[model samples]
Target: MARILLRSGKSPFDPVSPQQVIQQNLIATNTGNLLFGDAVHKMLLTPGTEITPNRYQVDPADADRINDEYDVFVVPLANAFRPSFKRHLNDLSALIERLRIPVVVFGVGGQAGTDYGTDHLAPIEQEVRRFCSAVLERSPSIGVRGEFTEKYLNGLGYSEVDVIGCPSMFMHGRELRVDKRAASLEDTAGLAVNVSYDSGNIPGSVIGNGLINRLADAALERYSDLVYVAQELKDMELLYWGDVSEAAGTSSPAPLTRSHPLLREDRTRLFHDSSTWIDALRERDFAFGTRIHGNVAALLAGTPAVVLCHDSRTLELCRYFDIPHRLVADLADETDLAGLPAQLYEEADFSAMVDGHGERFDRLVSFMDRHGLDHVHKPGGDDGAAFESELETVDLHPGMSSWKGGHDGGLGYRLAWLREADTRSRVRQSASDKRVRELTSRVGSLERQIEESAVLAKELAKANKRLEQLVKEVRSSPYRRLRRFAGRLVRRVRSRS
Candidate 1:
């Protein structure tokens, strides 16, 4: 089996409790639980955690267990190790620094929090540059998700970045098609907002009351239902919507997928089960959301979508893939969701948009070119030095080609990948949840003990009352007189005897 080190921040199977969802953003519904390294043969995850953030996807404890005997080591990045997972980022960067093997990244997200002209993403820009240096130092080139990422990296002096977009977006195919629609398709609007409380106040993902008010005003013009899509399971978009619904007293509310987690699952179950989302959105007239892959999924199902740009990732993907989208900031006070949806929903030629990606696609070609890599490669070619040299890094690559299109060694080895990554991340999370419950339960027990102390307090109060009564009686009564009489009686009796 191929051993791969993947980068995933949030566990997929993490509990999607309302409070928990509002508290964390671990599960990106579209990206699900994993990141780049799908090309790796016999893929095994060395997951990263806080203790060893460097090995968030691929734990350091599994280092020796996975370091050798595997074909290649894969390193992935979401937002290129932004401070969101700082310690983990350091660990990952350090691991890449010392990695003896070659690795290639697929659809890696880069951090462009700030522009280079100013101090915007300056500190993180350094970390990103450091990450890029390490990756390019080891692997030939690092594949970034989009143009903005590329621009940010290039600004930091990174040269060999490929704009591969998100692996989840490429999942359907190279191109996107805008589905046909009927006239006046009102009451079919979908708005996918990312309400993640886990991430520090992300303004980009929020559709607060004010925003909702604006959307509602817009809806009055033409829209019907406003669907809230969750980028991560911990997203609070549903909660926001729930509050909105309760306030409005609406009988129908938004749908929620709280069960998704960060663990690896069987492919059939993973892909197929995830497809139900399309069925859910089938009747919707149109959709727009902050989750990049959420829109991609809609587009994949031939449903038209508009992406609400949250960060560089969203903007980069839309720009790279030639998808129809608009910046969230671009929406003004006059901008209403209910007004006539743009040409993007209809007659916005996807082919033209894709062709419009001329500059962006060139970046991808440039990345592969710089790395001396190709989309597909077969082993045993002497001239294929780039693939061969990189092949030693990852077990699976485009290098291991078969007539059946991944039917032989790559596909045949699927069972091995499954066996290795068959890691029960859910169980781990559940055990963790159980431990949390146990701790909370202990707190409950202590509270009960404190309550029982009230009974003991009542008994003590009764004893105090009895002692007071005795003291009062001794003080008020002629105890001295009674004692004198008793003494006289005893003396007289003795004299008479």
Candidate 2:
């Protein structure tokens, strides 16, 4: 058996949130981290293979252990090539260079706005080069998300690059089908929407944040069952912790927050795992979101999805996979909220997208095979039947909700973990101190005994030395030699008799 190590952002064993999730909110609250990680893990699922828990963050300190523990390392990244992530890319590059085993990258892409410009990554060109070169050294070619990344890497003088889209999209492998139960938007339609309000760099883009919030507002008001999906930790924080006042801040678009009327009314939910996220979307009539993974989750669930592309990172993937999407700016001219979701659903056809998936899936498998990875879905085999069967047997984790109003599953979650850790530390410290005092008393007693023993040993040595001198003096006497000679002569006469 071979172990395929998954290098991801968060460990799959991340503590189940202590917060009790409303049963209705369970599917909506799954974090994208879990969603992405789960997809990659399941994608590589094969007989006689093992996958390690995510080794979060690339630290040079863990390189040796990683190489020794796993045979192959697979990285499924999203928009990893950006100035903001340059430092991380450098660190990962250094770590990759240290890895003696093969490293396969899937869906790694450069980030920019909708312009698809490469200028943003200029500062991190060397970092990207080093990272790509390191992966190419271990694998046949670097699998990229789309043409933009292909061009980006080619410009950097990397020839071994293939546009493999994203592994997350192929969570179910080749076969994908989404049915529109409703021809038009109905009040009873199960609508799922996601927004990416956490793109801090483009903080001021009205279309990026404001338009999605507007669409969400309209959908929530008109639809009976609408789920607003948030893909960032901050959005999750606001959903669970931020009070109405903080959510009402000018900086916050309340429509996407817990303060939203629908969210407050218990029509909103958050998801922490992909299984629930995908299952939740499976029940939805339509899912449209600014978050690429948000829509990708819908696609994986076989639900029709529309991506509100605000940047190049999303644009390229949508284009590559033919995922139905519209620019966020287009929503500005739209007036009717009730029909907008239906309109987008009708206009966006996923047949070509779904039809082309088989080839793309094969491309992914070929890439994996070239890197010596045996995937569950063989090229000409029964698509993803084996993968799905294996997935069904997985005892998946349940999604978590916020404990209260502050845990964003990042700092707040970590803070809660830290508090628990501190408490444990105090308890351990108390026990350790008690043990230390007991050991100290025993050591003192041992030291005292050693001192006493040393004195006795010294006295015994002096006595022995005197006894040795006395024996030497007695032996030196001529009388002692005459007695010994007489004893020997008597013994010889006795033996002769």
Best by TM-score: 2
Off by over 4 Å in 2: 9-15, 18-30, 202-209, 239-251, 255-257, 379-497
Error of 2 at 493 (Å): 99
Q: Estimate each model's TM-score.
A: 0.54, 0.73
Total backbone collisions for each predicted model: 33, 11
Off by over 4 Å in 1: 1-5, 8-56, 111-118, 188-213, 216-226, 235-273, 340-349, 354-497
Q: Per-residue lDDT tens digits of candidate 2, residues 42-89? A: 767666777875545568888899888999988877778988878878
Q: Which tens-of-lDDT digit does each residue in 306-369 have in candidate 1?
A: 7656456667767767777765555654444655354435534467554544444445445544
What do the candidate models score in CA lDDT, each in turn? 0.48, 0.73
Q: Best candidate per lDDT, number?
A: 2
Q: What is candidate 2's CA lDDT for residue 449? A: 100
TM-score of 1: 0.54
